[model samples]
Target: MKKVICFLAVLITFVAAFQLFRQKEGVENESYTINLRHNKSYHDETDELIYKGLLWSFSQVGATLPKKTTARGIEKVTDTLWRIDVSKLGFRPVVLEKWRRIIAAAKNTQEYHLYGSIMLNRFVICSIYASNHYYEMVQAPKTYSEFLHPSVNASSKAEYAVEISSVSKGERLIRMDTTVEAITAQQFIAVEGSGHFSQGNFKEELFELIDMMPNGQLRYLIYSHNGRLVNASPNSYGDAGKPAKCMWCHESYLLDNFMSTPNIKGYLNYEQFVSLNKRNNDKLIKYRKQLSTEINYENKKDHELAEIMYISYMEPSAETLAFEWHLSIEEIRRHLAKLRTHQHHEFPFLGQLYDRHEVDKLAPHKSVPIPKSIREPNDDEPNLLGAN
Candidate 1:
């Protein structure tokens, strides 16, 4: 009976000891997880994990294939900039196969040059215009009528130029604003001579030309000789430097529409495009008038005029400008003093000049969050290449 009791006691003791051991292990695991969650090191760790997976995938795919030269890795150009040669992995059959449908559907095959980048968790395939092709497109049109309208003649010799760029996020390929510049006096003449100075349809043909480009979203900016931003497409105010009225549409509906359909003609009907743009323009004029009334309503003439001028030219955040000019927050605030109108208003004159060191500190965390409705189809899914 005593031996039986002893055996029972030993068994109970063994069970208790095992429970304590497990509890200790669980506590230690919880601590480790909490530390990981709090620390910024997780970002770097995540990036490294993704990078390793990308490298392995590239190796596996590239091994069985031809030993062709391609852009395999990134080279740090500056402290803030890293340039990845896309041509290496960009032309690979494996990579191209993923985008076979998009490539097949593209209208102007000659315009696009494939570019690739391995981002945080996913690899991106960009379809940007080839450098030579872009140059050809931007060349001063042979006929006076072909030049972009509303030209600016500068003292120095100016050239007509256009630049287009795109980047992929999820399933959507977001095209950056196409910029058209007229730098020289002759270029200005060519631009103005292109079309009649009509109110509604001033640069209709030029707009049409831009629309015809592959994946073109009808967003463009025309800059004057002295680097003044003069015109923007979907411009509601018809005034240079004024914000577009269709900003929300561009950010949401248009983006979603293009991603879903991709084919320009099928999604964006010409008649609707013209009608919507014109409607926005009318709304913009009314908006500007209202804005003007608000600005003038305060009745502080000198102070208000100065504030308007500052807003028109500087276009910087109050904090940023203060830092740049070495002014105190109070002093900068006083300089930009105006009647409070909006709850979360940004000071109008905050400019974009940034020191390299400041820019570097901010760049890593700086991401533009795309609306969920316009997000890539599989953006929420775990990256297969990066999965353990």
Candidate 2:
């Protein structure tokens, strides 16, 4: 019985030793698992650290894909768009926007045009663009539209047009008429006196004529028959249209129908000022009252029919005036009325002097410290504040 008792004690001691061994190993395995999980989502060693009590970290995905691969000293990875090879530690990253491959995504932070403005093909480029970049297109840099009053558009380019109907039937004659200088309907002008005339699908012919013409210059006339048109001025007697105040057309000089004005006031050249003062000043001052004089607003009986006026052509002599841009008839009338009122005075109901072609002859608005000494002795100070 004593011997049996001794064996049982030995067995108990062995069982105790085995239990102790298993407990130690289990604790060691559990510690290893905790370490792996803790470090699994970390970047810096501190992220996996026990710290004083808790971990302090910045990145949530401490051990993320791209970053983690790079950290592991990986060699190469190939994808359809990218070939990432980290075996070579010193491989350069792509830094250009136009580069075919993207090595990294760069965060852009900028305001307007200096660095990351992202203004490609803006107004400084073409007169028109996608709606996103439409305002930035290149054209006459004005604050208003010469044609559409109380509204604003860039001046340098004529608006693109696609006629829906025929000019002969008076359905849609004005094909691509956007020039502010074109006051009377889509009447064509004569540059060198040999104005082009054609009909039908004639885009190719027009281009041919353009090729045959000089740089930035083309003279053409529309082929319109008499009495068929309404309130549309024709290039010739054969192209005469109807009358103003006619039942068929809408011809009213309402204020809001105008274009919006710009902030900086456009300037006129000395020559323009002199010419305007000599020839058109008195007549223009009396203009607003006679806006309808240029058109036939009379004859209440026949007013039901459209009346077309033949806006005569009068080119400025090279020696007479130097205009930086082309002038519209509407703008000319405004300036004459505003004369002596101050060139810098902005019209709330109107656009800037920039709408006038004369402004084109002068430099763009700049904060020049204009010397007071240049002021003419008889005239008011040669300068006035155009805008705030």
Candidate 3:
């Protein structure tokens, strides 16, 4: 009788442990708490080696690493989970690829390959190479005044001012680089200025571009004076590449308010400034009107231009789907397992992500309350422009 009782107790304990493990397997591997700042930036040889290795790893799978690839911020949260500061790397326009070694240095090459297989799929790398094709096709002007129409003599400044400036230190001198009727991509450049608007002492160190797409839609692009694309500029408010931070201020087109240029002798009068704004705005409206379907601004706002290009492609986790549809995590898991999906562990603790277009089809019939356990952070969390 004593032996039977001991055996029964052992069997019950084993069953309970198995049940607990199964439950955890159905959910995420682990939970994470993320902080939005990078504790360190790469500076030494070791850092460079790590960074280059990460670049090589990404290149192996034909993935275009994120544009900003210098700052390093990866933290092990628990034994099974890790968290990355996407906010810091993105706004600082710094490298978020510092963690490649963590997977590359796995137990063996096969495990490393497995990690790459899961993370480097088309859906996962979409954000990295979203704008590659378009950017590659663009023969950017050596100078904004070169390829754009109605070229300004680099020194010209528009008679416009705003109460809250975009650039960090100096005033912003607006210039329309294209003609109203130009068939090519319309262009605008905002340069840094100091003192009065008319006698604008423009600096070429920082600049912003508003380039028109072939479809007549507008996309913001940022560049340093050197012509290389930077994440943000001291001359403009838009931080993320493609100026992801600038979208809220510029909803569909230009701002309606046209403040008077400073009382400088050569500056355009308020009336002339207003007229120029109207002309530019009119061009924007005309181009946009050519579209039959409504533009999806939310999608645009959620990602940088590079990521926006591959918006349709994503590897979503159960939590991500649950948060997206305002459904319980369990329901999301139930629906996900029923679909054909290739599961892989995504970076920074996006565990068990599904690689399938069928995930997009699992829409909730009714609004379900999203549990607080699975809330997501804003991809483009606000940071002080040029603070880096």
Over 24-138, each residue of candidate 2 has an lDDT whose tens digit, in order, gives 9665433211111111111222221221111100000010123333333221122101121222222122211111111111112121212222111111111111111111111
Q: What stretches of model 1 exceed 4 Å from their correct place?
A: 1-248, 252-317, 337-388
The deviation in Å at residue 331 for candidate 3 is 15
Candidates 2 and 3: which is better by lDDT?
Answer: 3
**Comparing 1 and 2 by lDDT, which wins?**
1
- Candidate ordering by lDDT (highest first): 3, 1, 2
As for model 1, its CA RMSD to the true structure in angstroms is 22.8
Ranking by TM-score: 3, 1, 2
All-Cα superposition RMSD per candidate: 22.8, 31.2, 21.2
lDDT of each: 0.27, 0.21, 0.40
Query: Which of 2 and 3 is the better model by TM-score?
Result: 3
Q: Rate residue 245 of model 2 by lDDT.
A: 13
The candidate 1 region of ten consecutive residues with least summed lDDT is 32-41
Pick the winner on TM-score between candidates 1 and 3.
3
lDDT of 1: 0.27
Candidate 2 deviant stretches above 4 angstroms = 1-157, 166-201, 204-302, 305-388
> Roughly what TM-score does model 3 have, to 2 decimal places?
0.41
lDDT string, candidate 3, 1-388, tens digits: 9999999999999999999998885332121112111111112213333234333222222223334431332343433233443332222112223222222222123322333221222222322222321222232344544444554444644534432343335556555643346523456666543453444554445567776654444455556666655444442332223443344346436554333334435555456756776787776666555643223323333223222212212555665556445578798887777665444332323345664345644554321111111111123322111111
